[model samples]
Target: MSIFKPRRKMVVNREVQYDVLMYVGVFIVALFIVQVFTAYLFLDQVQRVVGTMSALEFIARYKISFLVYQIIPVSFSLIVGVYIFNRLTSRIAGPLFNMRRILQKARNGELETAEIKLRENDYFQEEINDINVILKRKSD
Candidate 1:
């Protein structure tokens, strides 16, 4: 008979990760939208002051001008924002993924010592260390 019991399951800590990412994503999107809208409004006002009353008139009057002035920069900035948010979310999810994997091993009795290194100021460090101590004592 096998001495070490297998772990049944371990749930990843999704709530904190999802909530934080959602808030950050929303804030970034809101900021980007606000900036774009503000720029559009400012440009429209400036164009009106300069007698470029209509978008069609303006675009026709200036070849590649509209695209050069607005479309390219906004599109590029939005793409960069998306890439940043993706990386941010991945970073936030990484620790949770590691913790879940370790917990799974612990559950399976494969982890006789829970010696996962946590950050010195990490909020969950205490909990993890406590669990590690308990596991160590139990093993001894």
Candidate 2:
């Protein structure tokens, strides 16, 4: 229902590649917000220098278009940010989610003997190996 839902499921120990991409995405969002603020400041200064009525006239003339330009990027950032974060989180969370469900089955003593598989794009190979090791030890 929300990003918060995925947040709860998101694996704490993610691969380095995922960490890098996630941080980079966050940095871009921050950079974009800063750019927007800087643009606002520049526009404000231009309006002040040009005098209020003239600035008001200019804004009135191009208000719709100007607003669209500003809104589009932020709206895109919001949409793309949610999408990227969702995907990024999913790549991490999905494996863990699968593992959790499998673990639940294992707890019920209904697990298959085959090693738990991860998606090609997913992480936690080390954890998977560890799980397999435990299973091997248990079987012996």
C-alpha TM-score for every candidate: 0.50, 0.64
Candidate 1, position 64, lDDT: 57
Candidate lDDT scores, in order, read 0.65, 0.69
Pairs that collide in candidate 1 are 7-108
Q: Flag regions of model 2 displaced more than 4 Å.
A: 1-53, 112-114
Each model's total of backbone clashes: 1, 0
lDDT by residue (1-140, candidate 2, tens digit) is 66554445565565656685766778697758856775785577556545546756877766775666677666766776677667767777777887787677776778656356788887776887788677666656
Tens-digit lDDT track for model 1 on 1-140? 99999987753545545666686778678667856775686577556446635767665665455556567667676777678666666655555576778778878888777555655433345556776787677667
Colliding pairs, model 2: none
| Top model number, TM-score | 2
C-alpha lDDT of residue 13 in model 1: 48
lDDT: worst 10-residue window of model 2: 3-12
